[model samples]
Target: MQSVAEFDNVGLRYGTDAETLSDISFKLFPGSFYFLTGPSGAGKTSLLKLLYLAHRPSRGAIHMFGQDIVTMPRARLPGFRRRIGVVFQDFRLVPHLSAFDNIALPLRIAGIAERDLLGPVGEMLSWIGLTERADARPATLSGGEQQRVAIARAVIGRPELLVADEPTGNVDPDMAVRLLQLFAALNRLGTTVVVATHDIHLLQEIEGAQMVRLDKGRLSDPTGSLKYPPRPLVLRS
Candidate 1:
């Protein structure tokens, strides 16, 4: 299978002395659903930030959609990000915006037509059981409802890759199950989904999920390929 994203001996350092991620590497295949599991502050969120183009690797290389992310121009970043959908741990919705508008933000930014936007947004909202709350503001909605809105918004563009960070963390157990089902359905339709979470029970119940466990910035399974290998030099001095 073709790879959607790859990190080759990637390391992320926030400052001069601190290294949050050291020599991490993994390949996310197309149409695969992966759980990025790790304890708190294990660089799971940092890794997602790299995947979504929020941060560039301090060492090594990351390829997204066949382009080298470290060297990707700032002007081109938005276009690359458009190819991916990200659901943040915090539902980063605009408080003043209506639920419909929040879900429609991506399409609107992409300059989609009004008529074309309504159908999909409406359909997705209904799918997430948020149809009646379309006009409600984010501040008025419950946590689960906001989470569903975030999911709907992220998947609104039918992006090829979806990276969700702790998507089910705040939702009830039943709602979490429903959200997982929704993600699975999207995966069937060819979206490569990577969900980062600490909920082992929830992830275990799902069948055929490729689990990528991160420990202190290193991947556990498939140790040989992803055990924070040393960066490859194009040519030794």
Candidate 2:
């Protein structure tokens, strides 16, 4: 199988703290669905940051489309990033932009004309089930609605790679199912999807979705799995 991205013994660190991620090695196969899971303080977000080229790995190598990202010319990073979509955990919606406009921003950046934006952006809002909220600003919408807008924006452009950080955290169970279905549909169409999440229950929601558990700072399986592992003991004697 072909790989879209590869990380060889990747490690990342903050200013003076210990490495946030260590010895992370994996190949992201083209057109696959991956769920990155771990407890708080785990390196899920850090890993995603590396995936989307937000932060370079502190050590080891990362290759996207067979090019070494660490050594890639800084001027070319935007071109690489244009081939990927990211749904930030923070929801990062522009405070003043309406939901529809926020979802349309990516296309606009890609040079789509304002007059031609309605079809796809409208469809995205409908998929987000927030057509009524289309004109509402992020500050006016509920958390879940804002999240939907963020997701709608991320997936609308249908980039080759989609990296979502805790995408379903703000939504309800049913809406979560809907969002997972949306991702699955996108995956089937050849978009590689990696979702970073803390909700283990989502592991069962998407069939054949590969689960990569980050313990402390290492991957549970380099190949990864969807099956649930034994739950950690929490009750005190």
Q: What's the TM-score of each model vs. the native?
A: 0.92, 0.92
Clash list (residue pairs), candidate 1: none
Q: TM-score for model 1?
A: 0.92
Residue-level lDDT of model 1, residues 101-149, one tens digit each, is: 9999999999999999999999988988989999999999998899999
- Residue 84, candidate 1: Cα error in Å is 0.7
Residue range 1-237, candidate 2, lDDT tens digits: 556788999999998899999998888877778889889989898999999999998999999977899999999998888889899999999999999999999899889998899999999999889998899999999999999999999998898999999999999988998888888888878888899998888877776777788989998864444233222211111
| Residue 139 alpha-carbon offset, candidate 1, angstroms | 0.6
Candidate 2 residue pairs in clash (backbone atoms < 3 Å): none
Worst 10 residues of 2 by lDDT: 228-237
What local distance difference test score does each model get?
0.85, 0.86
